[model samples]
Target chain A: MSTASSTVLRGRVWKFGDWVSGDDGIVRFSELRNFADDHDPAELARHCFAGLVPNFAERVTPGDIVVAGRGFGIPSHPPAPMALRAAGIAAAVVESTDTAFIRRSLNAGLPVVTCPGITDAANEGDVLEVDLAAGRVTVNGTVFAVKPFAPAMLEVVDSGGLVPYLARYLAGNARA
Target chain B: MRQTVAQKIIARAAGTETVEVGDYVTVTPDYTVMQDIYFYKNIKILEKLGVHEIAYPDKVIAVLDHTPQAAHGSIYVDRNRESREFARRTGFDNFFDVGRAGLRHLIMVEQGFARPGLLVFSDEPNISSIGAVGALNVPISTEVIVSMVRDSNWVRVPASVRFELVGSLPPGVWVRDLVQAICHDYGGGDGLIQRCVEFGGPALSTLSLDSRQGLLAGMYHAGADTALADVDDVALAYVQERADGRPYEVFTADADAEYDEVRTWDLSALEPFVTAPPKHADVVPVSDVSGRRITQATIGSCASNRLDDLRAAAEVLRDHPVAPGVTMYITPGSPAVYSQAAREGLIELFTERGATVLSPGCTTCWGYLGALGDGDVTISTNQEHYPGRAGSRKADIYLSSPYVVAASAVAGEITDPRPLLAREGKPHVHS
Candidate 1:
């Protein structure tokens, strides 16, 4: 199977600590009411990392990478992830994860690389080169291995997301 | 690759021979229900994706149980209007409005939408409640809500974590106790992360059908993808009573089916347990924290709102009035459950004992319908206890079983329920 070696990427890193739970870490449950009626994705993106770093939105540049400690997205809500995608987050790098969190991330069209020690791989504002096909990351002149996406998963992601994948699928099926 | 029960169900739904762990499959759901919170959000997403029509309206069930009907706020009023409007627009057939159903998961089974060997989906993540009926229930993410609106959703097959039950519970020990023990043993829930946790072995025969639902409740936030039990006589009868002649399939794991790992639990040795504040995994023995003062007590959720749970609470409140300065709320899981309890005089008994018996709905647990003031301490029958989950981060919430909740409400403090059970000459039990 084709692995991370063929999938190369570059982005500046925005870092955080361990156990950034899906609930408060991504966004507070109380704040969900703000976006409950009609949500603006960019507005949500502005509140990114508000629970940890209040000034995070001001610092976040498009196409930046998010590196965080173990068990990122543990509460398993999707708003923060949706915010990341809307904010043009290139990918997510976390130490480890429960598979449900992985599913949640991918379903939201946010690529996540589960490489242990990812937290120590780079500091905030450092540009890191990630090779998804090779399961490797180069940060500050040092390189390390990260888990790669499966061929099937890469296909879904490359197609943009599950919605787009299904659009192509239903279209082709209708043609057939 | 070896298949788990969850994989088997998903493969069957997709019309495939087999699927391994991490293999993605798209299956049309047998049923899909959304809580009131997601009702408008799903419609909005579907519209954003340029889908003007729902593909399977009959397959969708609309549940308006969260955020009380006639609640005194704009959030509640707007959501209730959107819920009705969505059902009207999509022509969804299985709409469970406030008076009809109390919890989305219970209504799916009681109304016979989820049965043996079916694939069920809901937008609500706490859907471990649906797994009790010998079916696979996936509480999907928002992205899949688009797929569901378009008639399909992708799912990765989950590996199985088998939990074998042995022996029977002693007096005053309950199924919630066993669930708490599993959480504690797994280091507050790491062993079964993202895996299907299957309950089997001889001890199941000793439990009632509703108790099986309790077994799935604790597994939700602990990160078990799904919790299941084989279709025993109890499960079979429960389904038969509610299935209404709908076609259903019953399945068990193949003899050669592989598990990630299997652990056996002796329920006989288990004791009543109460979870500490702010997290489900911070559990302690009830005796360890006896007499801690409580300001509020709430019983009845998808976890423990059946007739059996009501009877247990009634038994506790029998001849014992609720403690002054401690407010208690008892909400049934469904109109059927509340109607049955009312027919049996349980509602009057609760009211007579100074317990505020609310009809079927979710309140005080989800933090929307009713909220506690700051510095308040509450003991509830809810499983999830993230900070601010109950409307106030300043308040402390302790998760316990319904029996313990009732006893504690009466005492105005967290007290072990064994003494109450012994006085009634009954053993510790669950629905």
Candidate 2:
């Protein structure tokens, strides 16, 4: 992993009002799919953002991060996270996530970070300079109190998720 | 100092010293799984850092079960695009997309991803129930999971909050409502975080896996790390199928596990509970809130959208028209639940009785579906009733159990479920 002491992740901050329980809301940016259309909640969820504007995917700079208040995805739609992963954002830090979101994100090798009180600081378009070791965020040179990421979580963030982290480990094992 | 189940389990998993209350243990993660949405975003971060290859991709399962599809807005559209791009760029071989998949817990158990005897860390609450199948699994701190993927160990900390569930739950009352009630009764605060929650008493046996999942959601919402239920054959068999080469490990609290706080209640005395406004789970008795002229009533969501809950609601609404002027909406949890409800004619009963049935999903529960105009009052069986759950920020919401919600529909206001019990030929008891 590239060892940069600090990097300023710049992007618009999107806040999720609910929790990430299952696969719901993963495709909030798709063609405006409604759960009632197919009479299958899961099916309609896959068609999310079928016609919505400013899909989450299109709102990112390379280093942008997503933010949320609590309970991001409680509906448990499996493909919800995939849409976000597909969009190529840098990282996600939530006030809380459902276990489904955590499991699916990790299994899919996604990086999800959580701290109890992250919503207190950091606005939607504020440029953030994150110091990994110190676990603090700097906005306009002012450091705000952010929960320090767990070592494993930081690894996931550094490796971009579980798959890449595992791939590297597996390859190293083979090489050794 | 006594040890709780959480302490004992973490102690055994670490295989070192026996731990007492107030102790902590850092452990190696036996298994780690990621929800695909964040995984994709994390992948992009990794790519930027010029890092390739994961530490243990095989041990790690990449799940793409979140963000089912993007919505009509450009922002959501971009979210999906980024997710898809992350999946493609990461080269995840085990990605399970929409349509051909089940839930995270079901798919992991079905695909043999989680096993018994290992300490597993997950990001979700009910998803942690997959460990309930068998194993000394405990949902870890999210920040910890994100940070310590490389570390194989953690400090085994003891918990002070002890929540005891008693008696048996009535039909139609899922664990989510109970959880909300618990949070409502006892404020959900930092005090419960990192605590060990042991759910037991006869009430647990009556809970189905769906109910168990809901209860676990409560524990997670309370911010506790581990929740253990008594194991049975069904759990054993489920674990055996996915255990690969791992031996089964059971973590039970020694008769002497310490509990900083303990509270118990009889579920039999638990009536159709309801939380009035401002919050989904901040509960008030149905009797207290009845006659509030509920403009809307809805059923179906992760918290209350189970078959049993629907069956219970249908029995109440079968031939009765939703009290005049009350707009009723029913959205089944999933296709499977919908088909079962339909087979039983529950869907037909609700629709025939003037209740508008939205297809199975999070309709109206989220701000996206079953919308109401400003100043509308709604009664729903959902996890939370925080502002914006259904639309207008000025809307007044009353959250209740399915039975209570159905009863409220017939009463045209929030009414006690006790009258319904008598109407349905059952005895009435209140806690």
Candidate topping lDDT: 1
Worst 10 residues of 1 chain B by lDDT: B141-150
Write candidate 2's Cα lDDT for B1-431 as tens digits.
35665665566667765765544456656566655444555555555545554555555555544444435763446655665555466564555554433345445555656554456665444455554454444544232234323545344364645556677666444454566666665433334544556666666666665555446544544455556665555566656666777665665566766776777856656655667655333566556767788888987655566666677677677646799879888866555566778898888888888888765444566645667667888888755565444666578877766777888898898876555655667432211
Whole-model lDDT values for every prediction: 0.74, 0.56
| Candidate 1 lDDT tens digits, B1-431 | 46667877898888898887766677767877777666666666566666665677777776777766665656668767776776767676566776776888778888888898888776655566667778887767554454454566667677788888899987766677887887667634356666788888999778777787878866765657678887888778888988888888887887778888888989888988998865556789998888999999988777778777788788788878999989888888888888899899999999998888776766666665557778889888875666776676688888887778989998999998878878977644455
Candidate that scores best on TM-score: 1
Candidate 2 deviant stretches above 4 angstroms: A1-176, B1-3, B8-26, B30-37, B51-66, B77-94, B101-118, B125-164, B170-177, B188-191, B221-226, B237-248, B279-281, B321-365, B371-373, B426-431
Off by over 4 Å in 1: A1-9, A15-18, A34-43, A85-88, A95-100, A113-176, B48-50, B187-189, B426-431
What DockQ does candidate 1 have relative to the true complex? 0.33
